[model samples]
Target: MKVKHITIIGLGLIGGSLGLALKKQCGEALKVTGVDHDQETLELAVQRGAVDYSTNDWKRGVEQADIIFLCTPVLQIIPIVEQILPYVKVGGILTDVGSTKGFLAEKLLYMMPSGVHYVSGHPMTGIERSGIMAADRGLFKDKWYILIPEASTSPEAVEIISQTLTWTGARITTMDLYDHDQCAAIISHIPHVVAAALVNLLGKYPALEESFKLVGGGFRDTTRIASSNADMWADICLTNSQPITQSLLQLKELLDEMIQAVEKADRPAIHHFFKRAKVRRDILIEETDSHVV
Candidate 1:
C-alpha cells in the first residue's frame, strides 16, 4: 500500500532529514508531519522545508498517520511507541532510527497492537552535529540503513519501510535483531566510546594542555565523533550495554597485548601488529571502493 501520511516524531537531524527527503522524492504525493517537544526545533524544521506540518501534540500528529517514524534517542523510541500505539491506525507501520535495536525489537513486538506493525531501524549516517539546522536531505544518500525485524514483524511492514527509505538513496540491509546489535556494538557504539575515551585522556594531563594546540588533523579526525550528542550516546550505551561491554573487554585485551609488546621491546611483534591492522584497513577501503563502483 502507498503511504500518504507520514508522521515523524523528534524533528531532530534524522527526522528533519527524512522530512526533506520525502518531500524531495515523493513531492505532493506524500504529506510529512513533524512532531517535536521543542517549539524552536519545529520552527527551524519548517523554515528548512523539511516538514509540511509541525505539531507538538504527538497524538494529533500520529492519529491518522499511515506510517510513523520515531527519530528519537534509542531509549525514547519504545516509550513513544507506547504513547502512540493507541492513536496509530490499524495496519500502520511504526519504525525508529535508533542506534541499538535488540531490546526495542523485543518490546515493540510485544507492545504493538494486533493490526499495527513495528520494525526497528538504524540509519548508518549523520554528522558530528545535531539539531534541525544540521539536517541534510542527502545525509542518508549512499548510506546503509539497517532494518532489524523480529519474528513478529510483518512482511508488509518491512516492505513499506524499505520502499519509503529507498527514496532517500539508502542501501537497505536486513538482519536479525540480535545480530544487528552485535554488529552495531563493534562498528558504531564501541567506536564512539573509544573516541570519547581518547578525548578524555587529554583531560588528565593539564601540563600537556599547551602541547594539544599543536595537535592537528589526525587528532581532530579521530575524535570528531566524540562531539556527538552525549545524552543520546549515554542512552545507547546503557540500552546496549551487554554487547558494548563485551566489545570493550575485547578491545582492552588488544591494548594490553600492545602495551606488553612495547614494554618488552618486541619490535617484530609490534611490526606484525601494525602490519596486520594496516592490511585489514586496506581491505576495508578496497571493499568500500568496490561497493561504490
Candidate 2:
C-alpha cells in the first residue's frame, strides 16, 4: 500500500503529527502536503519535513492528493467534507480524525460525492498539549485507530487506509460508528467533562485550598484533560452529546451511590467500591500496550 501524495488538513497537533509520522515512517513512498489556516504552522510543518508543501487553499491541496486526512475538530469535519467533495478526485480516500463518529459518518454518507471514498477514523490517542510545537512524530506509535467503514465504502479504500495507518505504527480496529461514539462518550468525553468540572469546582472553593495542597499524581492525572482546548472539547460535546449525556447520567448515579454510602457510614460498600476500582485500574494497565481498546 503506497501513498504517493497525501494531503493533511488543519496541521495542528493531529494533522501535523500525522504528517511527521507519515513522512518519517513512509517518506520514501509518500509526499505529504499540509493545508493549515496558520502560516507559522505551515512553515513549521515544511521545516520539520512533515509535508512536501503547505497551503491554506483547500482546492490546491485536495486536487493533488491520493489521500486526505481531515484533522479538524469533530464539528468542523462535516462542512469541510462537504466543500471538499467537489474538489477531491474520484478515487481519493477521504478520512477524518474526529473523536465522534455517528453524526460525522451519517453526514458524510449523505453529502459524499459519487466517486469520492469516505471512511470515518478516530485515532484514540492525544495529549493535553496543543499546536505543531507539541506535535510529536511518534504520537500514533502503538496506538489504536478505529476505522468506521460504511456499506458504500470501497474494500480497496478500506484496505489502503488500514495498511497506510499501520505503517505509522498504529493498529487498525473496525467497529460500528455508533458503537464507537457510545464508547468514546463514556471513556473519553465524559472523563474530559468531569475533569474540567473538577477543576472548576476547585476554583469555587477557597476553603478547600488546604486540602487541595495534597493534590498529587492521582489528582493531576484525573484533571489533566481539563487542560485540553476548550473549543475542541465543546465541539465534541455538541456533536456527540447523546452518548455523552448518557455517560454523564450513568456516572452521576455511581457518584450518588458513593455519596450516599459515605453519608450513611456504609464502610463495607465504600470498601467494595475501592476494591472494584483498583481491579479495573489494574486491568486497564495491562491493556496499555494496545492502541485503542
Candidate 3:
C-alpha cells in the first residue's frame, strides 16, 4: 500500500518541511499537496517546491487525499479536525504533529468520520522559531517521534505510516496517549513555564539584568525554546494545565525543602539531593547524545 495523493494541512514550519521531506523520500511515488490558512504561505510552499500543489481551501483538498497530515497549532486541532472530518477520504491515513495529545486525540476520534484511519504522532524536535521561511528539511532527522495509535487503527495503517516517518530519519516509538501527555508535562510544558518565568525575572530587574550579559551557553541553551510561539505555548499549557500545575507544585515543594535545608545549614541534605539529580540528568544527557550520534 503506497501513499500517492497526500495533503498536508498547515504550511507553517513543520508542514512545509514535511512536504519537502516526503517529496525527497517518496519521490514520484508520493504526490504532495498542502493546504494553508495563509495564501502567501501556501504560495511560498509551492514556490519552494515543498508541495506539488497548494491551496487555502480545506474542503477541496482534504476530502480526496489518501494521506493527510495535520500540522496546525494544538488548540485549534479539534475544531479543524471536526470541520474537515466529512471531507476525509475513506481509508485515508490521518496523523498530526502536536505537543499535547491525549485529550485532543480522543476528542477527534469520537468526532472523526468512520472508515478514516487516524494515528497520532508528535516529532519531539524543533527550534524556537517557526513559519514557512523557518522550515528545515532535517528538523525531524535523528529525533524521536512518538506515535499514539488508537486500538481502532489498523495494523496496516500503522506500518505504512511508520515506514513513511522512517524515511524522514526519525526513530519511531509508541506509547499510550495519557502516558505521553503526562511525560510531556514534566519534560516539555514545565520547562516552558520555567523559562518564561526566568525571562520575566530578568525583565523585572533591568539594573541587575547586566548579569544576563555574563550568562553563558547553559543559560542560552536552557531558554532557547522559550522563544517559541506564545499563543501555541499558551494552548499547550492550558490544554494540559492540570498535570503542568502538578509538576510546578512538585518543583516548588522541592525548592522549599532545599531552602529549609539551607537555612538549617543541612549540608548533607543538599548534597544528597544534588547527587541524585545530577546522576539522573547525566543519564538522560548521555542517552540523548548517544541516540543523536
Best by lDDT: 1
| CA lDDT, every model vs. true structure | 0.89, 0.87, 0.85
Please write out the lDDT profile of model 3 over residues 1-293, one tens digit for every residue. Answer: 66778899988888888888888888888888999889899889988878999888878878779888889988878778777888788889888898998767777777666688778888888778988888878887888999998777678878888988887888899988889999999988888888888777788888886678998898888888789889879888888888899999998999898999999999999998899999999999998888874
Better of 1 and 2 by TM-score: 1
- lDDT (tens digit, per residue) of candidate 1 on 1-293: 88999999998889999899889999999998999999999888888888888989868889989989999988888777777788888988889998888777787888887899888889999888998988899998988899887777898889899999999989898988888899999989999999999999999999999999998999999999999999899999999999999999999999999999999999998999999999999999899768751
Of the candidates shown, which would achieve the greatest TM-score relative to the real structure? Answer: 1
Error of 1 at 18 (Å): 1.1
Clashing pairs in 3: 63-87
For model 3, what is the C-alpha lDDT against the true structure?
0.85
Give candidate 3's error at residue 258 in angstroms: 2.2
RMSD of each: 1.0, 1.9, 1.7
TM-score of 1: 0.98
> Can you list the residue pairs that collide in candidate 2?
143-291, 144-291
Model 2 regions more than 4 Å off: 207-214, 288-293
lDDT (tens digit, per residue) of candidate 2 on 6-79:
99998888988898898898766788889888899899989988888998888998897889999987788877
